[model samples]
Target chain A: MPEKVEITPESAVRAVLRDILGLDAEQVAGFDADTELFGALPELDSMAVAGLLTELEDRLDIMIEDDEVDGELFETFGNLVAFAETKAEE
Target chain B: MMLRLEEHNIGAILPDLPGTNESMQPQHAMDLDKWASALLSFSEQAENPTHVASFRGGSLVDHKIELPHWRLSPVKGRSLLRTMMRTRIAADKESGLSTSMSDLMETAHRDVLNLAGNLLNPEMIKQLDSAQPFEFSDTRTVRLESEAKEADAIVNGGPFWLRAEPSDDMDLVTAISNDLIDWVNG
Candidate 1:
């Protein structure tokens, strides 16, 4: 049987920021692991958050419950990546 | 006595609004007001509304609804409706209201197209509406074509192109397409 492939949260976050937010390569490249996201990035507004979560669910094939969303998960790039990773593993 | 409805109240009112599937016209403001009032009353009676009804704004204004988070101008009808729709979906999410698959698909379609118009060139956006085959991305090719369907069909059986790659993450692609369309349309 072929080994199951897994999507890393880092790649997912980068892809979502680049693809969904339309952030250019340079802008996305600037997002370090610790870079703050939710409030820090103007592109990641409320609507953008919804779109991101939905996209993440679709790409990672993970279900994110409404209650699972909170500020800490989006506090920084690392935080979001960790959250996605956890969800993907589950 | 004036009544005030907050953003959450507006959220509750949306699902109950008549003709939600149709685009709202400017002339329907009065009808919207009536629907809002009735919805508010029903919500109050249910005692489970997200927002409290209050007397404020003025005597004629029975429901002083406010969506502070939206920051929408009262003058713009289209903007108001859009904001309301967005807010309603968000609120429904919080309230655990199950959205139908068709409704979700429609919302996704609109959002994707809007984003596509934003990120892509006008030529690209226009091309998407045509029957000619073209590349949408490095991985996806699209072409529009017509199809015959039953009158009451829920799915839009054609006139829209299907992405060529079956194994690709279509949702992510659709999300990316939204930015392009949004740029073009805006």
Candidate 2:
């Protein structure tokens, strides 16, 4: 059997931020697990949420449902990374 | 050979008739209101040479007054005017003209978000950025990948055209239009 490919949440988050949000390399590089998101960032508005999610789904090859969303998931970068890791594993 | 109410701006005259708030109201209501207002205006102009007074429908005197020669035949033959008035009222309710533009746009924004929500991880949604117009560049690429072999090709320079399958969903179009309108208004 082929070896299971590993996907780190850090790489996934970085790719999503750069590709979908058009963030520069420097901006993305500065983000850490403790970084706050959602309401804290002016760029992270309601409209951008859709495009960002779409990018994450495409890049991570994971399915997400509307009912499963909550504020806690996006409270900080660490929360998001954990959520992504969970989806990736499933 | 048939007269349509939609040929005129009924919303201009009868602003309270439900869907007349926005330009997207039902075509039939608009048509009926236009025809009724025009007929009333024509009657007033014929009666008085210089005054050209505005006539608002719903007075006992107004109902008894006869329409000019041109409009008489259609009304007498099939009760077209009565039918049109009823149709316009029904159309108004269906068009949701009473809803404010801001409310409609807000609903559209939510719909776009919901559609995205279904396909994306909730956590990623929190990291979303502000909307931006998609930028297109000169270079384009086509790639093919498979288990054993992978190949990719790129073309650069000069004018380029990209084609995509057109979306038939009107809601999506409305959402995008509302977003652009918000951007412009801001």
Model 1, A1-90: lDDT tens per residue?
Answer: 122234466776776676556566578878887898877777666566665675566456676765687779889988888889888788
lDDT string, candidate 1, B63-115, tens digits:
33321111100112222223323344555556787443236336544342223
Clashing pairs in 2: B5-B31, B6-B31, B19-B97
Q: Candidate 2's residue-wise lDDT over B1-186, tens digit each?
A: 011112221111222332334545443233233434544565565534221111112211122224211110011111212222223323443567443323423444434222211221222122222211111231111211100111122111111100011224344334333332332233
Candidate 1 scores an fnat of: 0.02
**Residue B61 of candidate 1: its Cα lDDT?**
23
Q: Compared to the true structure, candidate 1 yields what TM-score?
A: 0.36
After superposing candidate 2, which stretches have Cα over 4 Å from the reference?
Answer: A1-7, B1-186
Candidate 1 deviant stretches above 4 angstroms: A1-7, B1-186
What is the Å distance of residue B78 in model 2 from its true position?
Answer: 51
